[model samples]
Target: MVVGYWRLAGITSGLACAAGALQAQLLVRAALGARHTSTLVHDSIITPFVLRPALAPALAVTAATPLDERWTAQVTLDFSTSTLERHDADGTTTGLGRVSTLAFTVGLRRPLGAGFAAGAGVGGLKYLPAGETGIFRSGAGGVLGLAGAVVSYAPPRVGGRWQLGIEARYDVHRFITPALRSEGFTSARTVHRIALALRAGRGGAAGAAGAAGAAP
Candidate 1:
Protein backbone atom coordinates (compact mmCIF):
# COMPACT_ATOMS: atom_id res chain seq x y z
CA MET A 1 0.00 0.00 0.00
CA VAL A 2 2.82 2.39 0.87
CA VAL A 3 4.53 1.60 -2.42
CA GLY A 4 1.35 2.31 -4.31
CA TYR A 5 0.91 5.64 -2.58
CA TRP A 6 4.49 6.62 -3.33
CA ARG A 7 4.05 5.75 -6.96
CA LEU A 8 0.92 7.86 -7.18
CA ALA A 9 2.66 10.84 -5.64
CA GLY A 10 5.60 10.44 -8.02
CA ILE A 11 3.24 10.44 -10.99
CA THR A 12 1.57 13.60 -9.75
CA SER A 13 4.87 15.41 -9.29
CA GLY A 14 6.08 14.36 -12.71
CA LEU A 15 2.96 15.70 -14.34
CA ALA A 16 3.28 19.06 -12.59
CA CYS A 17 6.94 19.42 -13.60
CA ALA A 18 6.12 18.62 -17.21
CA ALA A 19 3.38 21.25 -17.26
CA GLY A 20 5.72 23.90 -15.93
CA ALA A 21 8.36 23.05 -18.54
CA LEU A 22 5.81 23.30 -21.32
CA GLN A 23 4.68 26.71 -20.13
CA ALA A 24 8.26 27.95 -19.99
CA GLN A 25 8.84 26.81 -23.54
CA LEU A 26 5.73 28.59 -24.74
CA LEU A 27 6.82 31.84 -23.08
CA VAL A 28 10.26 31.69 -24.66
CA ARG A 29 8.70 31.16 -28.08
CA ALA A 30 6.26 34.04 -27.66
CA ALA A 31 9.01 36.58 -26.89
CA LEU A 32 11.55 35.15 -29.30
CA GLY A 33 12.53 38.56 -30.71
CA ALA A 34 12.49 40.73 -27.62
CA ARG A 35 15.72 41.95 -26.02
CA HIS A 36 15.21 40.83 -22.45
CA THR A 37 17.47 39.70 -19.63
CA SER A 38 16.61 36.33 -18.05
CA THR A 39 16.83 37.04 -14.36
CA LEU A 40 14.36 38.36 -11.77
CA VAL A 41 14.80 37.28 -8.20
CA HIS A 42 12.66 37.77 -5.11
CA ASP A 43 11.57 36.18 -1.84
CA SER A 44 8.30 36.19 0.06
CA ILE A 45 6.44 34.57 2.93
CA ILE A 46 2.79 33.51 3.16
CA THR A 47 0.95 33.67 6.44
CA PRO A 48 -2.47 32.02 6.58
CA PHE A 49 -4.50 32.37 9.71
CA VAL A 50 -7.41 30.22 8.65
CA LEU A 51 -5.08 27.59 7.33
CA ARG A 52 -3.85 27.00 10.83
CA PRO A 53 -6.38 24.84 12.61
CA ALA A 54 -4.56 25.04 15.90
CA LEU A 55 -3.20 27.84 18.03
CA ALA A 56 0.25 27.47 16.50
CA PRO A 57 1.29 29.92 13.80
CA ALA A 58 2.17 28.97 10.22
CA LEU A 59 4.43 30.47 7.55
CA ALA A 60 5.66 29.58 4.08
CA VAL A 61 8.81 31.04 2.52
CA THR A 62 9.80 31.01 -1.11
CA ALA A 63 13.09 31.85 -2.80
CA ALA A 64 12.64 32.36 -6.52
CA THR A 65 15.25 32.99 -9.23
CA PRO A 66 14.34 33.47 -12.83
CA LEU A 67 15.92 31.18 -15.42
CA ASP A 68 14.97 33.59 -18.19
CA GLU A 69 12.63 36.46 -18.95
CA ARG A 70 9.72 34.09 -18.48
CA TRP A 71 11.08 31.09 -16.59
CA THR A 72 12.19 30.77 -12.98
CA ALA A 73 13.24 28.18 -10.47
CA GLN A 74 11.83 28.37 -6.97
CA VAL A 75 12.59 26.76 -3.61
CA THR A 76 9.94 26.76 -0.94
CA LEU A 77 9.74 25.93 2.76
CA ASP A 78 6.38 25.40 4.43
CA PHE A 79 5.82 25.05 8.17
CA SER A 80 2.38 24.43 9.57
CA THR A 81 0.14 22.27 11.68
CA SER A 82 -0.93 18.92 10.31
CA THR A 83 -3.60 18.19 12.88
CA LEU A 84 -5.59 19.98 15.56
CA GLU A 85 -7.89 19.12 18.38
CA ARG A 86 -11.44 18.12 17.41
CA HIS A 87 -13.82 20.26 19.36
CA ASP A 88 -17.25 19.10 20.38
CA ALA A 89 -20.43 20.95 19.43
CA ASP A 90 -20.41 22.63 22.85
CA GLY A 91 -16.87 23.94 22.15
CA THR A 92 -15.34 21.34 24.41
CA THR A 93 -11.81 20.10 23.59
CA THR A 94 -10.91 16.46 23.08
CA GLY A 95 -7.90 14.89 24.69
CA LEU A 96 -6.77 13.25 21.48
CA GLY A 97 -4.12 15.35 19.73
CA ARG A 98 -2.03 15.25 16.57
CA VAL A 99 1.08 17.01 15.34
CA SER A 100 1.93 19.53 12.64
CA THR A 101 4.56 19.40 9.92
CA LEU A 102 7.10 21.28 7.81
CA ALA A 103 7.97 20.74 4.17
CA PHE A 104 10.57 21.82 1.56
CA THR A 105 9.84 22.25 -2.15
CA VAL A 106 11.57 23.04 -5.47
CA GLY A 107 9.82 23.99 -8.72
CA LEU A 108 9.85 26.11 -11.88
CA ARG A 109 7.97 29.24 -12.94
CA ARG A 110 6.90 30.82 -16.26
CA PRO A 111 5.94 34.46 -16.69
CA LEU A 112 3.00 35.55 -18.86
CA GLY A 113 4.35 39.15 -18.77
CA ALA A 114 2.41 42.26 -17.72
CA GLY A 115 3.21 41.40 -14.11
CA PHE A 116 1.64 37.92 -14.19
CA ALA A 117 3.52 34.62 -13.83
CA ALA A 118 2.79 30.96 -13.25
CA GLY A 119 4.69 27.67 -12.95
CA ALA A 120 4.99 24.27 -11.30
CA GLY A 121 7.38 22.34 -9.07
CA VAL A 122 7.98 18.92 -7.50
CA GLY A 123 9.40 18.19 -4.08
CA GLY A 124 9.56 15.64 -1.28
CA LEU A 125 9.93 15.82 2.48
CA LYS A 126 10.71 13.66 5.49
CA TYR A 127 8.42 14.26 8.41
CA LEU A 128 10.26 15.68 11.38
CA PRO A 129 10.13 14.41 14.97
CA ALA A 130 9.28 10.99 13.69
CA GLY A 131 8.87 8.37 16.34
CA GLU A 132 6.17 6.39 18.12
CA THR A 133 3.80 9.34 17.79
CA GLY A 134 5.21 10.71 14.55
CA ILE A 135 3.79 10.51 11.04
CA PHE A 136 5.77 7.33 10.55
CA ARG A 137 7.10 4.74 12.87
CA SER A 138 10.78 3.79 12.99
CA GLY A 139 11.26 0.98 10.48
CA ALA A 140 11.67 0.20 6.81
CA GLY A 141 8.04 1.17 6.35
CA GLY A 142 8.77 4.85 6.96
CA VAL A 143 10.01 6.90 4.02
CA LEU A 144 9.91 10.31 2.43
CA GLY A 145 6.83 11.34 0.42
CA LEU A 146 6.24 13.48 -2.66
CA ALA A 147 4.35 16.73 -3.35
CA GLY A 148 3.65 19.17 -6.18
CA ALA A 149 2.51 22.73 -6.56
CA VAL A 150 1.28 25.34 -9.10
CA VAL A 151 1.89 28.98 -8.33
CA SER A 152 1.42 32.53 -9.69
CA TYR A 153 3.22 35.79 -8.98
CA ALA A 154 2.76 39.51 -9.58
CA PRO A 155 5.67 41.78 -10.39
CA PRO A 156 6.73 44.47 -7.97
CA ARG A 157 5.55 47.95 -8.76
CA VAL A 158 7.64 51.11 -8.91
CA GLY A 159 7.58 53.26 -5.72
CA GLY A 160 6.24 50.22 -3.88
CA ARG A 161 8.37 48.13 -1.55
CA TRP A 162 6.12 45.08 -1.62
CA GLN A 163 4.80 42.44 -4.02
CA LEU A 164 1.96 39.89 -3.98
CA GLY A 165 1.42 36.34 -5.25
CA ILE A 166 -0.72 33.22 -4.93
CA GLU A 167 -0.26 29.46 -5.00
CA ALA A 168 -2.11 26.14 -4.86
CA ARG A 169 -0.18 23.08 -3.75
CA TYR A 170 -1.01 19.39 -3.41
CA ASP A 171 0.60 17.54 -0.53
CA VAL A 172 0.88 13.76 -0.13
CA HIS A 173 2.20 12.29 3.08
CA ARG A 174 2.32 8.56 3.84
CA PHE A 175 2.03 7.11 7.26
CA ILE A 176 2.92 3.54 8.12
CA THR A 177 3.30 1.27 11.09
CA PRO A 178 5.15 -1.99 11.44
CA ALA A 179 3.10 -5.18 11.62
CA LEU A 180 3.75 -5.26 15.34
CA ARG A 181 1.86 -2.00 15.82
CA SER A 182 -1.89 -1.88 15.25
CA GLU A 183 -3.29 1.30 16.78
CA GLY A 184 -1.74 3.80 14.30
CA PHE A 185 -1.31 3.11 10.58
CA THR A 186 -2.35 4.76 7.35
CA SER A 187 -1.55 4.98 3.68
CA ALA A 188 -1.28 8.75 3.08
CA ARG A 189 -2.57 12.17 4.02
CA THR A 190 -3.48 14.20 0.97
CA VAL A 191 -4.73 17.79 0.93
CA HIS A 192 -4.86 20.94 -1.16
CA ARG A 193 -4.00 24.48 -0.11
CA ILE A 194 -4.59 27.97 -1.49
CA ALA A 195 -2.24 30.68 -0.31
CA LEU A 196 -1.70 34.44 -0.59
CA ALA A 197 1.68 36.01 -0.05
CA LEU A 198 3.44 39.37 0.41
CA ARG A 199 7.03 40.43 -0.05
CA ALA A 200 8.87 43.60 0.96
CA GLY A 201 12.09 45.21 -0.26
CA ARG A 202 13.77 48.44 -1.22
CA GLY A 203 11.98 49.90 -4.24
CA GLY A 204 13.37 53.00 -5.98
CA ALA A 205 14.58 54.19 -9.37
CA ALA A 206 17.61 51.95 -9.27
CA GLY A 207 15.64 48.86 -8.43
CA ALA A 208 12.85 49.67 -10.89
CA ALA A 209 15.31 50.33 -13.73
CA GLY A 210 17.18 47.18 -12.91
CA ALA A 211 13.98 45.17 -12.90
CA ALA A 212 12.98 46.62 -16.26
CA GLY A 213 16.29 45.88 -17.98
CA ALA A 214 16.32 42.44 -16.42
CA ALA A 215 13.41 40.07 -15.76
CA PRO A 216 10.20 41.37 -14.12
Candidate 2:
Protein backbone atom coordinates (compact mmCIF):
# COMPACT_ATOMS: atom_id res chain seq x y z
CA MET A 1 0.00 0.00 0.00
CA VAL A 2 2.82 2.42 0.78
CA VAL A 3 4.49 1.69 -2.60
CA GLY A 4 1.23 2.35 -4.44
CA TYR A 5 0.75 5.63 -2.58
CA TRP A 6 4.28 6.74 -3.48
CA ARG A 7 3.64 5.96 -7.16
CA LEU A 8 0.43 8.00 -7.13
CA ALA A 9 2.18 10.97 -5.55
CA GLY A 10 4.92 10.83 -8.18
CA ILE A 11 2.37 10.90 -10.97
CA THR A 12 0.60 13.80 -9.38
CA SER A 13 3.86 15.76 -9.08
CA GLY A 14 4.74 15.05 -12.73
CA LEU A 15 1.35 16.28 -13.91
CA ALA A 16 1.72 19.45 -11.85
CA CYS A 17 5.13 20.13 -13.41
CA ALA A 18 3.79 19.66 -16.91
CA ALA A 19 0.87 21.93 -16.18
CA GLY A 20 3.22 24.64 -14.94
CA ALA A 21 5.33 24.38 -18.07
CA LEU A 22 2.28 24.66 -20.32
CA GLN A 23 1.11 27.82 -18.58
CA ALA A 24 3.92 29.92 -19.99
CA GLN A 25 3.58 31.14 -23.59
CA LEU A 26 6.02 32.53 -26.15
CA LEU A 27 5.30 35.13 -28.79
CA VAL A 28 7.47 36.41 -31.67
CA ARG A 29 6.81 39.21 -34.10
CA ALA A 30 8.58 41.13 -36.89
CA ALA A 31 7.64 44.49 -38.37
CA LEU A 32 8.71 47.06 -40.98
CA GLY A 33 7.51 50.59 -40.42
CA ALA A 34 7.92 54.36 -40.50
CA ARG A 35 7.74 57.15 -37.96
CA HIS A 36 7.23 60.88 -37.73
CA THR A 37 9.56 62.69 -35.39
CA SER A 38 9.44 66.12 -33.79
CA THR A 39 12.77 67.28 -32.47
CA LEU A 40 13.45 70.26 -30.24
CA VAL A 41 17.00 71.53 -30.18
CA HIS A 42 18.52 73.73 -27.49
CA ASP A 43 21.94 75.20 -28.14
CA SER A 44 24.11 77.77 -26.41
CA ILE A 45 24.59 79.58 -29.69
CA ILE A 46 21.41 78.79 -31.63
CA THR A 47 19.15 79.28 -28.59
CA PRO A 48 16.08 77.19 -29.37
CA PHE A 49 15.26 75.38 -32.63
CA VAL A 50 12.45 73.08 -33.54
CA LEU A 51 12.71 70.36 -36.19
CA ARG A 52 9.16 69.44 -36.88
CA PRO A 53 7.44 66.67 -38.76
CA ALA A 54 10.33 64.60 -40.09
CA LEU A 55 9.54 61.12 -41.45
CA ALA A 56 11.81 58.12 -41.06
CA PRO A 57 11.77 54.42 -41.91
CA ALA A 58 12.13 51.81 -39.17
CA LEU A 59 12.36 48.06 -38.59
CA ALA A 60 11.61 46.19 -35.39
CA VAL A 61 11.52 42.75 -33.84
CA THR A 62 9.85 41.73 -30.63
CA ALA A 63 9.51 38.77 -28.29
CA ALA A 64 7.09 38.43 -25.44
CA THR A 65 6.85 35.83 -22.70
CA PRO A 66 3.58 35.45 -20.91
CA LEU A 67 3.54 36.08 -17.21
CA ASP A 68 -0.12 35.12 -17.21
CA GLU A 69 -3.26 35.66 -19.31
CA ARG A 70 -3.38 39.33 -18.37
CA TRP A 71 0.32 40.20 -18.51
CA THR A 72 3.52 39.59 -20.47
CA ALA A 73 7.18 40.53 -20.34
CA GLN A 74 8.41 41.93 -23.64
CA VAL A 75 11.65 42.90 -25.33
CA THR A 76 12.07 44.81 -28.57
CA LEU A 77 14.86 45.96 -30.90
CA ASP A 78 14.38 48.92 -33.23
CA PHE A 79 16.37 50.67 -35.98
CA SER A 80 15.59 53.83 -37.93
CA THR A 81 16.97 56.65 -40.07
CA SER A 82 15.88 60.23 -39.45
CA THR A 83 16.63 63.30 -41.55
CA LEU A 84 16.46 66.93 -40.51
CA GLU A 85 16.95 70.23 -42.26
CA ARG A 86 17.61 73.69 -40.92
CA HIS A 87 16.52 76.94 -42.49
CA ASP A 88 18.08 80.39 -42.22
CA ALA A 89 16.16 83.50 -41.23
CA ASP A 90 15.77 84.28 -44.94
CA GLY A 91 13.97 80.93 -45.49
CA THR A 92 16.87 79.35 -47.38
CA THR A 93 17.84 75.87 -46.19
CA THR A 94 21.06 75.97 -44.24
CA GLY A 95 21.72 72.42 -43.06
CA LEU A 96 20.50 68.94 -44.07
CA GLY A 97 21.56 65.56 -42.73
CA ARG A 98 20.48 62.11 -41.56
CA VAL A 99 20.94 60.35 -38.24
CA SER A 100 20.49 56.65 -37.68
CA THR A 101 19.41 55.22 -34.37
CA LEU A 102 19.33 51.71 -32.92
CA ALA A 103 17.55 51.02 -29.69
CA PHE A 104 16.57 48.16 -27.36
CA THR A 105 13.92 48.13 -24.68
CA VAL A 106 12.24 45.87 -22.12
CA GLY A 107 8.77 46.30 -20.74
CA LEU A 108 5.39 44.77 -19.98
CA ARG A 109 2.22 44.19 -21.97
CA ARG A 110 -1.42 43.55 -21.15
CA PRO A 111 -4.39 42.66 -23.29
CA LEU A 112 -7.05 45.38 -23.52
CA GLY A 113 -9.87 43.34 -24.90
CA ALA A 114 -11.13 42.81 -28.46
CA GLY A 115 -7.80 41.83 -29.97
CA PHE A 116 -5.92 44.82 -28.54
CA ALA A 117 -2.88 45.02 -26.34
CA ALA A 118 -0.88 47.91 -24.88
CA GLY A 119 2.62 48.11 -23.45
CA ALA A 120 5.35 50.49 -22.34
CA GLY A 121 9.13 50.10 -22.06
CA VAL A 122 12.38 51.91 -21.33
CA GLY A 123 15.82 51.26 -22.85
CA GLY A 124 19.02 52.57 -24.43
CA LEU A 125 19.59 54.41 -27.70
CA LYS A 126 22.60 54.71 -30.01
CA TYR A 127 22.94 57.36 -32.68
CA LEU A 128 25.17 57.46 -35.79
CA PRO A 129 25.39 60.10 -38.46
CA ALA A 130 24.55 58.83 -41.95
CA GLY A 131 25.49 62.07 -43.71
CA GLU A 132 25.78 65.79 -43.14
CA THR A 133 25.84 68.89 -45.31
CA GLY A 134 25.34 72.65 -45.20
CA ILE A 135 25.31 73.90 -41.60
CA PHE A 136 24.83 70.42 -40.17
CA ARG A 137 27.92 68.35 -39.44
CA SER A 138 28.30 64.79 -38.29
CA GLY A 139 28.94 64.69 -34.59
CA ALA A 140 30.54 61.98 -32.52
CA GLY A 141 28.01 59.19 -32.21
CA GLY A 142 27.03 58.12 -28.71
CA VAL A 143 24.51 56.28 -26.58
CA LEU A 144 21.48 57.76 -24.83
CA GLY A 145 18.22 56.94 -23.01
CA LEU A 146 14.93 55.93 -24.59
CA ALA A 147 11.35 55.20 -23.51
CA GLY A 148 8.30 54.15 -25.50
CA ALA A 149 4.78 52.78 -25.55
CA VAL A 150 2.98 50.48 -27.96
CA VAL A 151 -0.55 49.47 -28.89
CA SER A 152 -1.33 46.59 -31.21
CA TYR A 153 -4.33 44.78 -32.65
CA ALA A 154 -4.43 41.23 -33.91
CA PRO A 155 -7.24 40.03 -36.10
CA PRO A 156 -8.73 36.63 -35.51
CA ARG A 157 -6.81 33.73 -36.95
CA VAL A 158 -8.23 32.48 -40.24
CA GLY A 159 -7.24 28.83 -40.08
CA GLY A 160 -3.57 29.78 -40.17
CA ARG A 161 -0.60 29.19 -37.91
CA TRP A 162 0.20 32.87 -37.79
CA GLN A 163 -1.80 35.86 -36.62
CA LEU A 164 -1.58 39.26 -38.36
CA GLY A 165 -1.69 42.61 -36.60
CA ILE A 166 -1.18 46.33 -36.74
CA GLU A 167 0.87 48.15 -34.16
CA ALA A 168 1.52 51.78 -33.32
CA ARG A 169 4.20 53.16 -31.04
CA TYR A 170 5.47 56.40 -29.56
CA ASP A 171 9.01 57.01 -28.38
CA VAL A 172 11.08 59.70 -26.73
CA HIS A 173 14.86 59.99 -26.60
CA ARG A 174 17.50 62.54 -25.67
CA PHE A 175 20.75 63.01 -27.58
CA ILE A 176 23.35 65.53 -28.61
CA THR A 177 23.12 66.30 -32.31
CA PRO A 178 26.43 66.91 -34.03
CA ALA A 179 25.04 70.15 -35.34
CA LEU A 180 23.66 71.02 -31.94
CA ARG A 181 26.91 69.96 -30.27
CA SER A 182 28.79 72.35 -32.53
CA GLU A 183 26.57 75.05 -31.02
CA GLY A 184 26.95 73.58 -27.53
CA PHE A 185 23.40 72.31 -27.04
CA THR A 186 21.36 69.10 -26.75
CA SER A 187 17.99 67.89 -27.99
CA ALA A 188 15.02 65.72 -27.09
CA ARG A 189 13.09 64.01 -29.85
CA THR A 190 9.67 62.35 -29.99
CA VAL A 191 8.68 59.77 -32.60
CA HIS A 192 5.35 58.25 -33.57
CA ARG A 193 5.32 55.09 -35.64
CA ILE A 194 3.07 52.40 -37.13
CA ALA A 195 3.53 48.94 -38.61
CA LEU A 196 1.75 45.83 -39.89
CA ALA A 197 3.16 42.35 -39.37
CA LEU A 198 2.65 38.70 -38.54
CA ARG A 199 2.84 37.17 -35.05
CA ALA A 200 3.64 33.51 -34.63
CA GLY A 201 4.23 31.03 -31.78
CA ARG A 202 2.23 30.14 -28.72
CA GLY A 203 0.40 31.99 -25.95
CA GLY A 204 -1.41 30.72 -22.87
CA ALA A 205 -3.70 27.83 -23.71
CA ALA A 206 -6.56 29.64 -22.01
CA GLY A 207 -5.96 32.65 -24.23
CA ALA A 208 -5.90 30.45 -27.30
CA ALA A 209 -9.06 28.72 -26.31
CA GLY A 210 -10.74 32.03 -25.58
CA ALA A 211 -9.61 33.42 -28.93
CA ALA A 212 -10.88 30.37 -30.72
CA GLY A 213 -14.25 30.64 -29.17
CA ALA A 214 -14.50 34.33 -30.01
CA ALA A 215 -13.50 33.94 -33.65
CA PRO A 216 -16.20 34.42 -36.26
Question: What is the C-alpha lDDT profile of model 1 across 59-147, one tens digit per residue?
Answer: 55666544544455667666654343333444564423444456677877665566555556666554343234421344424444656
TM-score of each: 0.50, 0.67
Off by over 4 Å in 2: 1-24, 40-53, 87-95, 131-141, 186-216
Model 2 worst lDDT window (10 residues): 207-216
Instruction: Candidate 1: list runs displaced more than 4 Å.
Output: 1-56, 86-95, 129-143, 155-159, 166-168, 175-186, 199-216
Best by TM-score: 2
Worst 10 residues of 1 by lDDT: 29-38
User: What does candidate 2's lDDT look like per residue over 6-104, in tens digits?
Assistant: 999999999998877655345566766776665444223354344432567778878776665567777999887766655344455533567667889
Clashing pairs for predicted structure model 2, backbone only: none
Q: Give the alpha-carbon lDDT of every model.
A: 0.43, 0.63
Model 2, residue 117: what's the lDDT? Answer: 78
